[model samples]
Target: MTTLLGCDFSSAPSRRKAIVHAVGHVDRGRVVLQRQDRFESLDDWAAWLADDAHLPWVGGFDLPFGLPRELVEHLGWPTSWVDCIRHYASLSRQDIRDAFAAFCHQRPIGGKFAHRATDGPAGSSPSMKWVNPPVAFMLHAGVPRLLGAGAEFPGLATGDPRRIALEAYPGLLARSVLGATSYKSDEVRRQTADRLIARRTLIHALENGDPPLMRDAGLRLRLTHSQRDALADDASGDSLDAVLCLIQAAWAWQLHERGDEHWGLPAFDPLEGWILGA
Candidate 1:
């Protein structure tokens, strides 16, 4: 079986805000959690992924794999995935900020951000946004490693076939389970009882395969009592998000096994890649 992984990334990871990865697979209609690992630095995570033993794995990573096509076109960057990413990698953080700032400045106040086509369905922040979530920096920090690792991104780069990466948004999965209820907060003061309850509800939904996405595929999550508690108690939701991505990765891998073209993705713009389960 292909090793399945889900990654919750941090653009500027540190000991306090590490990247979380869930590693395991789906077996007998159940998504099993073998382990969850933490990496305080992207370099360390990259090195871990580069190990030969880690090949033949497919991962759903919570990071933007493509920029907004509108922004790329306005900047006159290459429209091809590899070329566009190469060009984006060459830019400094300050350079990216200036360019994105200029783009926002030219737009109307309420429409300051340029969004990718997938943003609507995925309900993700604009990939060009430089602050708050800082996903722009995530692409800057994460995509290069994926490229260098030769991970194949469907509809993007067909790199090392054994190592596949799909752009994923955990919010999409969580929202399906909890609707608009918020289940995570970085601020300790904001990690209220309501959020904790919501996390438990979300976990219950996953275990039952209540969502149509899971129900249709006959998939239910299997977690130990301790593992479930750990995911629910993580106020930042990084651990839960990693598991969500892992489920998404498993769905895509299942589709691939069934010989589905594009690995279950809809008709997508190659320059603006689609999220795996969106």
Candidate 2:
């Protein structure tokens, strides 16, 4: 059995809002939710990834693994994904914000942010956007740590073959089931009854493999009653998002078992990595 992980990442994590990891493995066609781990700091998360005891695991992380090719070219940065990530790592958050802001300033309204090709299929926020979702900062903070841990990103970069990392977006799964219904919120006030209901509905669909995407992948989520309640009761949705990512990781592993070298990801620009399901 292949160990699997699904991570809900934060560029700047603290005890109040830590990075959440859902750890499990695929059994039969079920993606079982074994446990959840939290990291209050990037250092802690990176250390966890580097730990040999955690070796031979494939993980789906909810962060952009690379920047938009257009943004990289516009900044005259190195076209190589590794070199560009190294360059990105050297800049502080303020530096990144300023640079991305300048890039947006040069473009016209409605086209302010450059996006990766996966953004269209994944329905993700632009990787270069420094605000709102702040995925640019996510890419800034995440890619370097993955590199430092020597995690292998299929078709993008080579590292520890035992530690495979793939880009994942939980929204791709959630939106497929719930459409535009908002299922969770970080703010207490925004955690409405309807959102809670939506979460339950989404979870049901996942467990039963009701969605075409889930059925096609031949994967369903398996959670204990306590686990089910916990995932639904968390108003923040971080735990649930991590589970969604875990499911994606399981789908990738299924493909690998069938000998898909790219782990089901299509041919994509190495400088702008593709999301696992997208």
Q: Per-residue CA lDDT of candidate 2, range 54-88, in tens?
A: 87999999999888899899999999999999999
Looking at candidate 2, what is the lDDT of residue 264? 86
- Summarize candidate 1's per-residue lDDT along 1-278 as a digit string, tens digits: 78999999998889989999999998988999999999999899898778879779999999999998999999999999999999999999999999999989999989999999999988999999899989999999999998988889998889888999998889999998888999999999999999999999999999999977788888899999999999999998999999999999888888888898687799889998999778
Give the runs in model 2 whose Cα sits over 4 Å from its true position. Answer: none
Report the error of model 2 at residue 14, Å.
1.2
Q: How much does candidate 2 score in TM-score?
A: 0.98
Q: Each prediction's TM-score against the native?
A: 0.98, 0.98
TM-score (C-alpha) between model 1 and the true structure: 0.98
Query: What 10-residue stretch in candidate 2 is worst by lDDT?
Result: 210-219
